[model samples]
Target: MSTRTPLDVFLSDQALAEAREQAKIPGTLAIAITPAAPGTQCSWCDCDIALNETEHRCKGCPNPAAVIMHQFRHGSPVRVDVPLCTGCHPDAARFVLALAQAGGTR
Candidate 1:
C-alpha cells in the first residue's frame, strides 16, 4: 500500500491551476504559497518549512501580485523565487534544465 504524505508534491509557478496541473505527474505538488512572512509554505509540497529547515527557490515567472508590485513596476520581469523546501528544489531544477536542453518549450 502506498501512502502519500504532504511532503510528496511539487508545484510550478504557472499563473493558473490548469497550467500547473498539466504536468499531471504523480508525486508532485500544486499549492499556492501564502499567509506567511513573504510566503512561507513550500511551493512544491505546501509543507510548512520549520524554522530550522533550509529553503530554496527557482527562477520565477510573473504572477499577479508580483507583476503589480515588482516586474511591471521595474519594466522587466523581476527575480521571483517561489519558496520551496530543500527536498523539492533539486528535482524541479533538474526538470527545468532538462527542458532547456530540449531546445523547444513545450
Candidate 2:
C-alpha cells in the first residue's frame, strides 16, 4: 500500500518525467503500484520508483497509456485503469508490443 495519496502521486516531478517519455507511445499492460518507505521492492519488478509514483496509477497520471490490459482477467470494463510503476512501465509496454507484433495466433 502506498502512503502517498492519488493527488500526491499525480504531482510528482520524477513521475511526470517518466510518464512524458512514454506518453507518445501507447501501452497496454499496466502494473499495479506498490509503494515502499525507502528501499522497498516494486510490485511488478525491481526498482524503488522513489517519487515516480503516478507512473503506477491510471487515476494518478490519467494517461491514455494506462489500460485494463485484459478484459478477461476480471470480466469487467470498469477496471480499465491499472496502476504501473516507472520501473516496469517501459518494459511492460515494449513486451506487450512485441507480443502483438509477433502475432501469437489469436
Candidate 3:
C-alpha cells in the first residue's frame, strides 16, 4: 500500500476545492469576424459574424477594465451582445492577421 503524508493530503484537498470553485465560472463564447460586405464567413473561423471594416474586436467581448472605463463614456464601438470564442479571439498574431483580413482588429 502507498502512504500519503498529512501535508500532502491537505494540499490535495485544497487543490481539489480550488478547482471546483474555478469550474463554477462559466466559459466565454466565441464569435467570428467576417468582411463588411455580405456573402462570406468570418476570415478566422468563417462563422459569418463580420460587421464593418473599421470595427474590430468581437461584439460583446469582455475587454480590459481600463478599456471598458475609457470606452464607456464614449459608448462601445460595437453594441452587439455576441462575443467571439476564446479560440477565435484576436489575441494571437496569427489570429489578428486573419481578423484584419476580414476587416476585424486585435
Candidate 4:
C-alpha cells in the first residue's frame, strides 16, 4: 500500500486549475527542453533528415507538408493527429474527407 499525507489527499480543484494555468505561462519557472538526437528521422517516411517542431521534415521531397487531425466516432469519439509526408498527405486527406462526407467512422 502507498502512504498518503493530508496535504496530498486534500488538494482542491481550484489549486489544480491554478497549477495547470501557471504551467502554461512561459518563464513562470525555469525549465530545459532537450532537442532530439542528430540524424533523427521523419516520423512518416523514416527519412533521416532534420525535423521541424512537429517531428517532420524541414526540407526536400517526401517531406511532411501538413499535419492533420482526424476525429473518429464509432461508439465513443476519438481523435487522431499525425504528420504526413508530401507523398502520403494528399491521399490521406482525400480518404479522411471522403469518410467525413459519408458520415462514417472506423
Q: Considering summed lDDT, which 10 consecutive residues are worst modelled in model 1?
A: 64-73
lDDT of each: 0.35, 0.40, 0.34, 0.40
**Cα RMSD of predicted structure 1:** 16.5
Per residue, candidate 3 scores C-alpha lDDT tens digits across 1-106 of 1354677567645654454444344431123222122221222333345566445553343331111000001122332322233344434336544654674432
Candidate 4 on 36-73: residue-level lDDT in tens?
A: 22333224443455545475543433443333323323
Order by TM-score, highest first: 4, 1, 2, 3
Q: For each candidate, what TM-score against the reference? A: 0.30, 0.28, 0.25, 0.31
Backbone clash pairs for candidate 2 read 31-83, 56-83, 56-84
Q: Which stretches of model 1 miss by more than 4 angstroms?
A: 1-39, 45-80
Off by over 4 Å in 3: 28-106
Local error of candidate 1 at 95, Å? 0.9
How high a TM-score does candidate 2 get?
0.28
Specify the highest-lDDT model's number: 4
Identify the superior model by TM-score, candidate 1 or candidate 4.
Answer: 4
RMSD of each candidate? 16.5, 13.6, 16.8, 16.1
Give the range of the ten consecutive residues with the poorest summed lDDT in model 4. Answer: 29-38
Give the per-residue lDDT of model 2 (tens digit) for 28-83: 22223223333333333334466658665432332222222221112222322334
Candidate 2 vs candidate 4, TM-score winner = 4
